[model samples]
Target chain A: MILPRLVFESLLNRRSTIVLTLITIAFSVALLLGVEKVRQDTRYSFSNTVSGTDLIVGARSGNLPLLLYSVFHIGNASNNISWQSYQHIRKNKKVAWSIPISLGDSHRGFRVLGTNSDYFKFYRHGNKQQLDFEHGKPFAALFDVVIGADVAKKLNYTLGKKIILSHGVGKVSFSDHDDKPFAVVGILKKTGTPVDRTVHVSLQAIEAIHLDWQTGYKNPAHAVSAKQALKLELEPKTITAFMLGLTSRLSVFSLQRSINQYSKEPLLAVLPGATLQELWSLFGLAESALLIITVFVVLSGLLGMLTAILASLNERRRELAILRSVGARPWHILVMLCAEAGLLTAGGIFVGVALYYLIIIAAAPVVETRYGLTLTLTGLSINNVCMLLITQVAGILIGLIPGIRAYRMALNNGITIRL
Target chain B: MKNQFISIVMLMVLTACEEPVNSESLQATWEDLIQEGFTPKELILKYQIDTYEADDPRRMQLIRAMEEEWNSAPVNENLDNKKITLTGFIVPLEIESNAAYPTVSEFLLVPFLGACIHVPPPPANQLVYVKMESPIAMPNDGEAFSVTGIMKTESVNNELAEAGYNMKGLSLETFSNESLNPNTE
Candidate 1:
């Protein structure tokens, strides 16, 4: 009981240094937990990007690249599948539904996908949830287009707004499809998937906009007004990739086999789930590295506290001598020093958890829109509880360092008149 | 070259002379086939919608049953050689024309909204093989249209599927949005 009062008085004597120590530990704790939270949320959102799709088919390419282009819209396809191949596969008896995606255009860094009205009816994300319309309806005409939630919000686009697309997938491109601008007809609700960053147009419009170009040059003779182009055939010659949903869930492998062995063209069909698992396995190495780095950072923060407490021990020598005169033992001095360290660590943890929530609330919107990651405000997990306990234990171990130093000082120094 | 052009025009004019049966007098003669133990519900399950993974045992069983039923379905002989006007979604199987003007000449008419594109192709009986003499322009993607033609109870196999019925289509026109999907009829 007396030891508690002594510990409190000793900490109060050095309140400024103790407060600084608390702040440092709190910052470290926040960083460590923040990394863990972001990692979990990233995995959740990425895996949830495509659900209803069984296979993502594309022209023969690497599995990761195909997934990147078809699902994430991160990169361009190496090759394009012939429209005939898409039709043949789309019409397969085993294929319940297929949405052909023709990429290669962008509007302000966001990918532009050319598809049909069936996309609105069949495309799903986040555990088979169909897309909902925040405002307006699906594209009805060739020039009508639908913008994703992030696109609508970031670009400030609304219904009846006209937007032009660039011919290439660069952040900025000189060649623009300004002649055939599309009007935004629909804006989908936020999905926290790559779909949120896409701009959708009719497949015919994709063809219509490119009618004037042949071999990367705009031929003046082929140049026609949007109305005139509509009169001509708008069948797509090639598409970047397509996703297929089978009628029978048991026929997925068989259909994937058939698509892989397709006689018309060289094609590749990857099961989205399996490919995603493989991708995550590759990323596991980087994730562990990040975890290890954060852990070391936390350890260093605790060491800083130990250093602060040890430095203050020099000035507390006289205080300890005076306590010794008042009948305090060596162990009492040790307990008082350890108690102060424990109090600072516990206070730091409390503040750290509060700060973590504050940072998450502030950054959730930016993270969701920028990275397509949904940082759900989940409660402390079992692992996190274990982590907190470990952090507290580490603090106690660090506290022992200064505790031993003060114990030795109190034992060696007497209540004599020596400086 | 001029002579070839004139001959092609003459052939087109002759083929276009046949009149489609008036919609008022024409009746779907194959409507009886649908009544004979034919419900799309039995062939498909509600849980199977929008799923593509081939891991469900129930889905496999249902698909096998669908294929079996499709093979055993009896075609109506009365529907053969009859002129009718049918509305359904078009899946372009073949586009034919000179380089200057391309039009869809051979296509499949499906009975549902997303039959050929979004969903698995419907059973063979539900699909109508259409061959047009004067190919019409391809309509909007997955848009249903009315095809007036002489229906034939012919089985034709393509890379896509085996179509149970064929039609010699004469004219094609866009369907009014409300008139599509003769699910009731």
Candidate 2:
């Protein structure tokens, strides 16, 4: 203990250099730990997005894409399912209810989902069912709109507010759907899902806006006003896809089979749970990679700390010998040095964790918008606590080399050259 | 050190025995399953809609599950050729040229087999969209009997998920056209 006190004081005397090194090591540890925490928490948030829904039926596509467009409000469906196909599947005895969806349109950067009220009625996610209202209710009439939690907050919208649909997604939206301006009817609570950032409208609205427009984009040469569009037939001929639920649980397979085998359309049915499981397996590889990266980073930080202290051993030899001559035991000196190294590592990790929380609080909105990932600044996890312990132990073990050398040199020097 | 090594070996052994969630139904060819006494109910729960078009609370759960099953299958493209029964809806894709179902002809098969999006190789939980020669109309709660074709993966079009494992081609046969299986319950 005495030796460690002396060493801490000695390092303190060269406070400028030592403090710089300590800050560097602390930030590195923070980076390492931050990476690990973000990786784990993001995964948890992702996996917990939709828990209650039993199935996620969509056009035959990659599981990730299907999930993305349907639930997350990211990307666009490759094709649309025929109304005929959706109707046939919906009529199946096994189907409970259906939520018909028409995707591939956007209002500003927010995605516009062309879906029926059944989406609000029958949809379930995370721990709860039904979309909770942050301000208002679901759109009751056609041409009405319902904004997500983020959309509402970011745009500062209220009930009955009118907004136009942008032709494209992101900052630079091309031709606007000025003719079919939708009134904000609902504001959904923050679910930390993509829905929070989306603009929900009836399937009719989707068809109404695109009645005269061609695929990809409308001909800018023949742009029509919103009032003029009202007079035209806004009936939608095609939609991105439809979500089907069977009346009876047993009939889902038969219904899916029916849909897939449709003679008129090349279609597919998918169970959300099954595909989610599959997608998770695919992500498992990334998880392993993340684990490896985190391990390497943490190891590197510990090694750097060890290297710095060990390099300073030569300067500390005289101090150790002086202590030995003053009746300090060699073993005691070793313990003190190891303790100080351990304390430094533990202290650095602590600061790193604190910094991560601060960053999360600051960048929550940015992460939500760009990456579509929702992060919560919570307390330390058991895993993180374990990491702290591991850091402490590693610090002590690495310092052992220098600690032993100092002890040996002190014993050899004896009272003759205590200085 | 020796004890530590043994513990690690034991942990590895235990972890390796975990069961994968692949469909455990009879491994019949895609045609055989369709032709046989098809049980739609059992298959529906196993192969439901994959509302993973967007990253919502609903889709995230599906993505996680799909990722879990991506490792076992090396087959990604040409899903119809795999000779396994798939349960899904009739979704017309946007790729049909002069087909019966024009707009929604090229579609995906989800849930049971999700082609991974961002994940490198597509998850086996999805099947990529493919075009059939003739447009296949869906019977209300219908079932088809046909010999699925072989695998074909290409980097031509942007698919449902982000990347990896896109469906290329398929052969759709109407059930009324043939009696591959004679015996009926």
Candidate 3:
């Protein structure tokens, strides 16, 4: 009891210095935890975006670029694969299902994806979870469109709301497909992926809107009305990319090899998992660098506390000597110093955890909306708890330095004021 | 001092809770996976593979026959449902989402490095589809792992049918040269 009182009184005497050291420790702990959380959540968000699909096939391009453009909607495809080639490949006996997607269109900054009903039936994300409808069903009519949760929320679209798409993939487009407007029939539930930023319609609808824009601009002389265009042939000539689900997982590599070696066209087939692993390998160095820096920040914070305590030992030698003359054991002095360190470390950790939650609560929504990465709000993970424990242990060990020094001085100069 | 002792004991208990490697697991070599007396080199020689021109129709027939033989190759029934440890390179089948690292949950364990990308893949007997109990960080290309699991002789068939062994992986460890030549022990 006396040890704790003595430790508290001593800390209060050095309140200003102690408070600054506490803040340094708290901030470093918060930074370390924050970096770890962001790294984990980013990986989680990206990985959960696409699943169950065995392969993503596109016109000859790098695997990472194809994955980004086709699945994540982060970039544009280099070229389009001929519809004939897609049809021929889908005819293979090993293909369980296929979903072809056509890009290069936008509606109010959101990408417009052209696909058939197979997109809803076969596409999966996050542990084989199927996409569920929030409001309506899949697109039934040729001109009926389906919007994702984010697009619907941001744009304030509802069932039967008519919206026209732009010809090019940009926030603001010069050419709008005003002649052919699509009615929103379905709204998908929030997936926390790029799917929430997509507008989906049938391949025919995509072709219909571009009927008069063959030469990259509207040809008014030969323009077809929306009603007339619906009656004409609307088979898609090309598709940006397609996803494939194989009948057997074992055939994936062999099928990918065949597709890559296809004599008729230059194409690339990549396993989504393998390509994702490759992408993470590219970021592995950066992620490790961030973690290492945060660790050093934590080390410096502890070192600061050490430096302050060691410097204060000189001034406190008289106080310790007087206590020794009053029959205080040398071990009692040691325990008091240890107790002070333990309290500061525990307090710093508590404040740091509170601060971490405060920052996460404020930034989660912004991160989700801006990057499509959801920051999950949960209790501290096991890893975080372990790290905090290790930090506390380190803090106590640092206390032993000042503790032993004071013990030696109290024994040598009992009741003597050593200036 | 008593509290310190208790915390140390608690740590020991926590570590002890992890699943231990089964002591009864049989060490299996890649050769044990293949059908007895069937060699790829001998098969190629018997089919006169080197003599055929690139466009020869007979060569195509021989290739098809070889594929059929490879698919139909029987797995060792003695090893079925037995706890076994085998070392091989990995070809990831399923990767877990939301992981800070690229962790693989399901993968194919092949007898040779580059088996997935190379022109010729191992036969059905030589391929083991491993489903891990927990995901592991993705290993570098050509890195080998010693996997312990219960081996099952299962045929996965679709329109284009394929047959291979399945393994419910219990544990995985990095394979070293010491594991290859156990006589050194």
Best by lDDT: 3
Query: Once superposed on the true structure, which residue ranges of model 1 sit more than 4 Å away at CA?
Result: A417-419, B1-185
lDDT scores of the candidates, listed in order: 0.77, 0.61, 0.84
Off by over 4 Å in 2: A1-11, A214-235, A247-254, B1-185
Ranking by DockQ: 3, 2, 1
Candidate 3 per-residue C-alpha lDDT over A221-315 given as tens digits, one digit per residue, 9 for 90 to 100? 76989889867888999999999998767667668888998889999998887777778778789999998999999889888888888898888
DockQ-best of 2 and 3: 3
| Per-residue C-alpha lDDT of model 1 across residues A250-330, encoded as one tens digit per residue | 345447767877888999998765566556667678989998998898898899899999988887778888888989888
lDDT of 2 by residue, A1-419 (tens): 35656767766776765565566557766766677656655655554555444345666776678876777666777777777767776776556677888877677677888887798887765544567887888877767899988888888888889999876566657678776678998899987767787898887778777765765567666666666666766656666766655432223344555565668877767655445444555766887787787677777777777777777777777766667778888887777778767767766777777777788888887987778776666667766778767767887787687778777876787756644
Model 1 residue A112 CA deviation (Å) reads 0.8
Tell me what fraction of the real C-alpha contacts between chains A and B each candidate also makes. 0.00, 0.00, 0.33
Docking class of 1: incorrect
Cα lDDT, model 1, residue B111: 67
Q: What DockQ does each listed candidate score?
A: 0.01, 0.02, 0.27
Poorest stretch of ten by lDDT in candidate 3 chain A: A410-419
DockQ-based class of model 3:
acceptable
